[model samples]
Target chain A: MIHAIRARIKQGHRTTRYPDEPMTLPERFRGYPRLDAGACQDGCTKCAEACPFGAISCKPSLSLDMGKCLFCTNCIEACPKGAITFTNDGRLAANTRDGLVVGPDTERVLARALDNKMLSLFGRSMKFREVSAGGCNACEADTNVLSTIGWDLGRFGISFVASPRHADGLWVTGPVSGNMLEALRLTYEAIPAPKLVVACGACAINGGPYIGSPDVCDGVDWTLPVDLYIPGCPPHPLTILDGLLRLLGRIPEK
Target chain B: MTSTMRTFRNGSALPLGDVPVLETESFLKAILDATVHGWRVSSYFGLPRGGGLRIYCLMSSDSRGSLGMAAADVAGNAFPSIAEFCPQIQMFEREVAEQFGVVFEDSPWPKPVRFERRLTDRTAAGCRTGRPSDVGVMEYYQVKGHEVHEVAVGPVHAGIIEPGHFRFQCYGEQVLHLEISLGYQHRGVERLVLGGPHPASLHQMETVAGDTTIGHGLAYAMVIEALSGTMAPARAHALRGVALELERLANHTGDLGAIAGDVGYLPTASFCGRIRGDFLNMTAELCGSRFGRGMVVPGGVGFDCGPELAETLLKKSAAARTDLANAVELLWETPSVMARLENTGPLTAEAARELGLVGPAARACGVNMDVRRDHTFGIYSMAQIPVATASTGDVHARTLVRWLEAEKSLYFIDEQLRHLPGGACMGKSNGLAGEHIAVALTEGWRGEVCHVAVTDDAGRFARYKVVDPSFHNWPGLAMALRGQQISDFPLCNKSFNLSYCGFDL
Candidate 1:
């Protein structure tokens, strides 16, 4: 196996130079949703309608409640003028639950300060217990790939624990389903007292495409409490890595 | 393609007699008889759908094909239990009885399937009022043993594996019975796909089982295309074949590494892991995603491999071939690895066929039922690769077969790339019409993924049932692990790598 070790070393760090160099995310990588108000039509509410969770408010002005946005591209895909696009920049964090509302910026400085503090609060070297309520398995695939020999997430000191009891954070994917509600709750409850729940995908935070499923609950937040919401249909590995480091207080709060 | 499917439309029923279709009890028996000659009744289920009860029976005859059903027009009170015919059908029958509230006449054990204890008493009933709770039907057969110790392992495990509960009844590591409790990670993926959006909306269906994504997606898309009577372009088909072969290579490499790890061969584990990583990177380079995601679409592929990626792939394919060659040599040459692997988990060819095993597991036990060769699709028939099999039916034989298959996959990938035709990838279609069609057969990596899609008049989905390969292979894994020691369970399980979510859905 000396040859294998030498080969790995010669491969010379397969990981991306993220947080230093700009992340080279894959094409079609789902991240945070940004709405172009210029292209936004008056009272055209396809994006709001397409949202599995009622994350967008189509009242006087197009308002997006970041707390409830599932980050699924049904809205972006539904947008007539390609007004809505999923931005790869995933630097969203907040102190209070209400601090995560992303609409017309009001009290911007205060919200930014709170988000920075929350990002700094959690430290580096993270541990996670990933919970899937009702996803298509895209997020889970990327998550598994993160720890493989190529990604080697263990080098970053980020490991996926089997038990929630031993975890400091919960990485939840998929839309919450009616069947897995009990299991999800028990898993979250099983996590220790001082734990955080990071809603990984659009499905978890909002409902993604399966919002009104009869067999499944629309959103995970509809059942249990959520701390950090990482938006994406299935967020890129770098987006997840960035969000994870932000949670662990590694990156300087932006 | 050398097609194994020999369809008989107007052939006579095998059971020699037809009970009235409305006679639910006799009808069930008649269907079972048609499936097997002796017709040893295995299991039965009472499923409730469309405002009525549907009775289902699972049966086995000899060491070939067993039969199961979704019986129509059966009232809850009149269905007869087949527990006496074959004792193995007990679990399935109990599952049906609990979930759909089907009352079986003269069942050996009559208990609520989902609920553990009967809450006939007022106190238990009082606690359940006015509260919305998530509770599943819990019904299990109570088989008492003489000092049978129960060990409950987890929905959450120590390793970074998916959640599953393994309840083992043993006398100090010599296992008597193994009861698996799953549905912990039941994501309701099928349910989401059925009602939510268009079939094209869910690209993640391929990755649902992770390893079996290419196989499952190809099956699903083929069925969808078949129903629509549309075939993808030649180049798209070739790309799909390449993706499927790469998937097989990656999974086989990982499985070998895991098997070595289980048997305490750390060097082999590290070597396999490193090579497996390279294999995955090669996949990423080819498809732009590591797990081969988004490469497969309903009509055809989402992306095409350009000349640059093709050249890179060809080079990497050769390197992986060489790496696996060296690794296989090391595994076979090492004395300790061989000692642990040889004769560790042996399932006879008879037992394997009886259990209806599929994929590499069945091939290792001498069942030459490969989907690519027997029931050809995509570029498999044109490429003409041999269906690799082993007669030993041991862990060593399985390892050899897998290694050989990886070599074959490399060869197949190389061939597909060399003959890469230029054309449009996708085909245009207005989707499937409103007709029920049963798309059944085996995929390369997993055994069989059967998809039944029925659309309404307006092209709205009415009923879609996806039976994953894991559903058929889980029982096979259980059978393989029956007589083996507790330590051998991981090796046996890793040999199959059955998907919990795929089966649960």
Candidate 2:
């Protein structure tokens, strides 16, 4: 125990001071994507064709759906016109589903916190029940990491409860598959009324890479009414925490 | 013995027509003989041929460092079950039957491998036979006694982990039998990868079991490169090796921490948890994603390591290594942690070998089998790390083996980074050779990850089989739980940490 204490003391304060202080992300960290429609050559469908998931649509203007994007930057490489680039900003979560869509003119898409009425109920404390429906476990793993001492999600009054009965909302990850659809619905129903559904990662919002697979239901929006969409193949813990904080009105909307 | 089966080296693509197609009886005899003579079945699956199924078995001769492939065409809807002679092939046979509707005549424990609903729907493209039962609603082994009781634990667990059903028949606190039923995380990964290296194939491979992204990604990349008759650059191989070892370091650290947590040891649990994140952050530094998702591509790695980044990695890994040693030493020294781990969930070497266990679980049982050493590939062929093992075959053995391996992995990363080859991290991959079969094995942090891809005449994948180590080790976990305390199930389960989705797939 003494040795552990000594080790802990030596590795002092590993936790990131996010919300209160800015977190330093790596240089290559792919986050919110920026689109330049004018840079695209007329009638070129390179970016759309390059996307593993149909996250990009060329014919209807160069729009990148952050919800479906894996943040793999495959489109950026395939786009000879340099039409799409990812900004290092990790705050890509949004309150509405349509808000996740990034057009050429859109500079940034920030997650708006809940309305004043909803905030009053869940603003101070929000416990979530995480249900992984056909998720790859990446999103789930990242979410669990938030509970670690470094992230200390409990510090923000956001905790993942074991039982749905204790939850104020459902934090759903993965593309909802036919097998998990019933269980997911049952889990959502188990939560009390006036509950929120926060879909984390690209798979939950728009099926990410497993987009058109018949096995999956595309995203959680096909079943539950998603209140928040956190995008990434598996969004970093910082991104997930930022979204949850914004949802609970803990972090001020940018 | 070698004359009966055709042999090929690891990562070599053989012409589809070159594999010797033996008579059904002879094929069965050959597989049984190989297993009896110490060769293990690496992969066993069926491919569609002339509206029927052609069974292929890939056996690995670990000592010889060669792989054997044998094939047999099913005459009708049923094939003779070799699983009785070679118990290791039972699950593979069941999987083949579940997917292709081939009946294994008079086989013991014949049941659906994944209990997939689509496999029962006749309208489904690959539904050759069998009706889909409700997932996790199958007959389980029961212990009938005055005070015997059955405890059922989730397809939805209390912990923030993936879903899988565990049924334990216990008398008081002692477990008589544990049956693991998993299909909950099934997302038709194999079905999704059928036609071609579809745009989503690489991404699907990465998520086969999300934790082993680099492992599966490396295996799939090797499969593509093998089939295409190309090799990744030396620098690319080095980068892949770095990523793979980093993955091992992170996961091992986390598993050790989780094991400590399961036993109620908080210090190591908390400290190792943070250290695990440090390793993941190092990976994020490499490829911008914590899980190393976008780091590995087909031809080579997606990211490059320059001198400055290499120096940073070396420094960070050195720090993590020191921190991990300090944290994990506490688990070894503390008597409470030691008591909870030692002799709990003991899997004998005999049982482990018979069950065809792979990875650390097998190594913990003193089985000297590691894909990286046995089937050399990438930088592993150039630089070898000693395979760590323990004879106890308990939670402690698994824990110790992981720590030792993590130490080696850290050393490996430091060495590789300090002497990183200066060259392109990717190479040109031409179109795959048509009508060929390729097998690629990677020693993923968990265990051996095998990817076998067979191409059509048009250079597209006709059949792709992924054998996650969890497929071989989940049974070992079940066997370990026998005659043990029921409460230790979580500890035993963590020691293996088998992937439900990987197995379900």
Candidate 3:
């Protein structure tokens, strides 16, 4: 008991005050991206060719699909003119799939509030059933990290419930492998109507690494409509939180 | 080890022709002989050919400090099952049978392992085989009696975990038998990497078990490097070592906390949970991904660390170390935790060995089989992390082994960071040597991550087999459940915490 108390004292109050306060991410942490399509000298498709998943294309106009991006520096490394770079800002979520697409025109497409009914229903307290369709456990791990002492996502009145029947919506990740599609559908069906579907990670938004494989159906969006798309290989906890908070109209729209 | 087999060290490439294609009897004999001679079966899988399949078995010996390889080209679909004599190869043979449609005659568990065959292949093989349409749909072994009941749980579990089904044969509160059905997470990784070293190969490796990014990633990278006839620079080795150990620290801390959580202990669980994130953030500090994705690249690492970052890691790791010690010690100090932990799910050393368990579970049973020390790869070749072991194979033993390994890993990380080698972290890659087989083994946080890459004539991958530690340890988990209280399932399961996706892959 004494040891527990002492340990608790030493590990005192480690939760972050983000959204209200400025989030301090690592220097090397690749989050939101910056693209300078105009900087290309001639027909430079280096970034597009360099990308493993074809997330980048520079034919008529250079554009990046944030949903398909793995956040790897392959594109940035391949670009000789230094036209592409990833910013430390991790707010790369959007309400629509097109919103996740970035070109010279699209500076940033952030997630917006769900309709007033959603705000009235789930703005205060929301329970979700997280389904790892074909997830690589990273998304699942980071999602679980939210419930830990530091993040304590439950403090925001957002919690992952045991059953989909009790959940307000579905939180999906991975490329949605064929074997898991039935289970995911059954889970999504179990939740009450007017439910939210938030797809986290590149896999959940677009088939991240396992794209084009016959084993997986593209993503959760292939079968079910995704209300919010948080794009990262596995989105950082802050990114996930920001997406959640933004959906609830909690954060002041920038 | 044998006249028919060819031996090579880990991370070393051998010409594929050097491995003698023995007759079926000799192949089985060589494998059984190698096992009797104290070599562990690292990887055994059948590669598909025209009509039949070629069976290859790779074994590693800690005492002899070598890896041996031998193959047999089966003319037709059938191969005589040695899984009857060697229970260790049961899962591998089952996997072979499922993937290539080869029938392993006279096996104990003749069921499909991970349901690797596609519907088209299943139909093409023979529709009359009557295979299940989907993964996890198989005939489960039933224990029938007057008061017997079966409890079937999940492909969709309660927790935020990958999917797998578990059927428990129960007599009231006591579980008589437990069978785990998986393959929900199979994305055809081995099949996907069949052609050239596709751009998605490294990405696939990183997520083979995302928590084990450093482990599997390192193994895959090492295989690529060996094929290219190059070694990652010393500095890269140092950084990879640090990343690998950090991964160990993060996962072991999480497992320790989870074990504590299972016993209803809150303080340690809560503290270690945050500390676990701290380690992950440190990994994020390395290559931006908390899970170490895109960190381990072929020929070297993707990122480099300067002195400033090394010092930062040193300080951060020290802080995590202190917090981890404080938090974990509470579990030891707490009598309730200890009472709940000790002798709850016991596996004898013999059972662990027979079942071919690896990683912490095998170590807890006093199997001194850490690939880092035994089959020394890049950084482990230079410096050694002592194999942590415990004699009593129980939840308490597993927990103790994990905690001990965590401390060692912390020390290792500190040592590697402080002495960060000078020079380039990345290296120039030469073209891959054709018709070569390289067996790369890494000591992942879970266990030995063995990746065997065989290059075709045009310097492309003929076959790539990844044997994640979960493949070896899942059966041990089943054995651990025998005759234990059904309520203790969570505690016992947490103790092993094997990767479902890694196993399925």
Report, for every candidate in turn, its global Cα lDDT versus the true structure.
0.61, 0.87, 0.88
- Per-candidate DockQ vs. reference: 0.24, 0.53, 0.57
Against the true structure, candidate 1 reaches a TM-score of: 0.78
- Leading candidate by DockQ: 3
For candidate 2, lDDT tens digit of each residue in B99-119?
A: 888999978878877776433
How do the candidates score on chain B by TM-score?
A: 0.81, 0.97, 0.96
iRMS values for every prediction? 6.8, 3.6, 4.3
Look at candidate 3 and tell me the lDDT of residue B151: 99
Instruction: Give the range where candidate 3 chain A is weakest over 10 consecutive residues by summed lDDT.
Output: A214-223
TM-score order, best first, reads: 3, 2, 1
Task: Give the DockQ (C-alpha) for candidate 1.
Answer: 0.24
Instruction: For candidate 1, give the docking quality class from DockQ.
Output: acceptable
Instruction: Give the residue spans of candidate 2 off by over 4 A.
Output: B117-133
Looking at model 1 chain B, report the run of 10 residues with the lowest lDDT sum.
Answer: B8-17
- Error at B253, model 2, angstroms: 0.7
Each candidate's number of clashing pairs is 13, 0, 0
